[model samples]
Target: MNTGRDEDALRWDGDDDPTLDVGTRTAGADPTPDASGHDAASGEDAPPLALPDGFTAVGKDSDTVGHIEADGTVVMPGDKAPLSSPMLITLGILAGVYLLFTIGWIVGGLRLQGTAQFLVSPVGYQVALWLAVAAPALWFVTAYALTRSSKSWVRIVWLLAGLVVLVPWPFIMVGAVGTVAR
Candidate 1:
């Protein structure tokens, strides 16, 4: 072991290294047999790869660490992990609500075609109508993606607020019932 080095320089204390050659053999010296009667210098008998000083081999079975799912999903340490059951249910409900909003938009847009004339052009009205319908779904997806690391309550509050705020106005007004003649 080289000594009298700078304090800041990186050093490896191999004196206590279990992987170090146990015999008093010099580097580049001819290989010798170990106490177990196996050739010490031979790669076949040695632990798969040399471990750092003071570390013991955990064996090949220990390689499969962390959370591994049967579906081939591997969740490493510090990973985001999968959503909980309640969260999954909430997301499903939100998707259903968004689908309903889209249906409502289509129904209302068709029903109001003759009654409510587009201030701009027919194409503009269609674009606006479709965009309005898609907005809630887009918002939900965006919010879900953005708030992935946030608390469950925070995500729920944000999505619920969006649900209330992004209600399709045309659907509420005209709807599938069509114009009411009073």
Candidate 2:
């Protein structure tokens, strides 16, 4: 649709091609130059990130690397890759542990009103069960958080271990309060 009046080829307003600032609007056609003798507006092309193949560009055409599955599906995952079974398993374990502990507390409290089906110390039994589940879940969470951190694994391990050691103190204190009140 260009009239093709001038000598220099028209440049796109944007690198995306659709919003072109062609012809006289280009930096090449800028009348004023900076101290370096080149137009300051010429550095616009440096923002784009390079990408690999199989990821075909669609509308708006950003320079970001889009993910392309082997089945030819395009997914823009950004900084993260898809989770594997191990990762999903780890997440599931964490969720299960937290849920078990929370539900156990509620159920134990409800059963405290003279239920023959519940244990002598229903809350203790529930706590023990939840602790059993928490061990592996904590291991996975600590290892994951530590491994992903920039700090040394030793430091991360120590920090998480300290937190683990400290976590049960409040529960122990509550138990002591009950014993002392009796």
Candidate 3:
């Protein structure tokens, strides 16, 4: 009996909360404005949602798939979509292979050039030929790498810009030294 009496007293104290209302009892049931739970924002009276009344939904082409109201942004036909993973990977692999091949060629040419005259079987002409051919091709390969590396395009661009500064700087110094020698 005493336990039940204490529980009743606590419940009695809760009745005086001025902020409590009927809306709080069934807040999430629905938005029906009626005698039981009426809403002031009736159909015609409520602010209109910003959706357009009529529009068309388009897929990758002129073909229409569905209707859209003012609500949605549409993707027009033939938009340059993101490249697929296979394409990106293929390009990256090609870039890597080309880079490796160019590096090998440069190194090989240097080795051949250095040992050409001293070796028992003379290789000067062959080495010089390879160095001349590979050295110019390396520039083309580097240009291709810069173009193909979409993932690192920004980095490649900055690297190339730096290379522009570096490649000519040494030549300038070398030319100056030659002039001084003359």
Candidate topping TM-score: 1
* Clashes by residue pair, model 1: none
Q: On residues 1-182, what C-alpha lDDT tens digit does candidate 3 reach at each position? A: 45687568567665878777433434454443433224554432322222234544344422423223343643323223445677567546655544554554454444545455575345656755455445434654665566553455554564455344323222233333323543
Model 1 root mean square deviation, Cα atoms:
15.3
- Stretches off by above 4 angstroms in model 1 are 1-76, 177-182
Q: Give the distance in Å from residue 140's predicted Cα in candidate 2 to where it truly belongs.
A: 13
User: lDDT per residue, candidate 2, 1-182, as tens digits?
Assistant: 77765633565335666556443445455544443335445533322233356445555535344566565555553445556677567556555654554444344433333542264575675566456446544655565676653434454455446445434332333333333543
Ordered list by lDDT, greatest first: 1, 2, 3
* Candidate 1, 26-86: lDDT as tens digits: 5785474443335655433432223333444476534323455566565543567788898
Which whole-number lDDT from 0 to 100 does residue 1 have in model 3?
A: 42
TM-score versus the correct structure, for each prediction: 0.55, 0.29, 0.28
For residue 144, model 2's alpha carbon misses the true position, in angstroms, by: 12
**Which of the two, 1 or 3, has more TM-score?**
1
**Model 2 stretches with alpha carbons more than 4 Å out:** 1-62, 77-80, 107-182
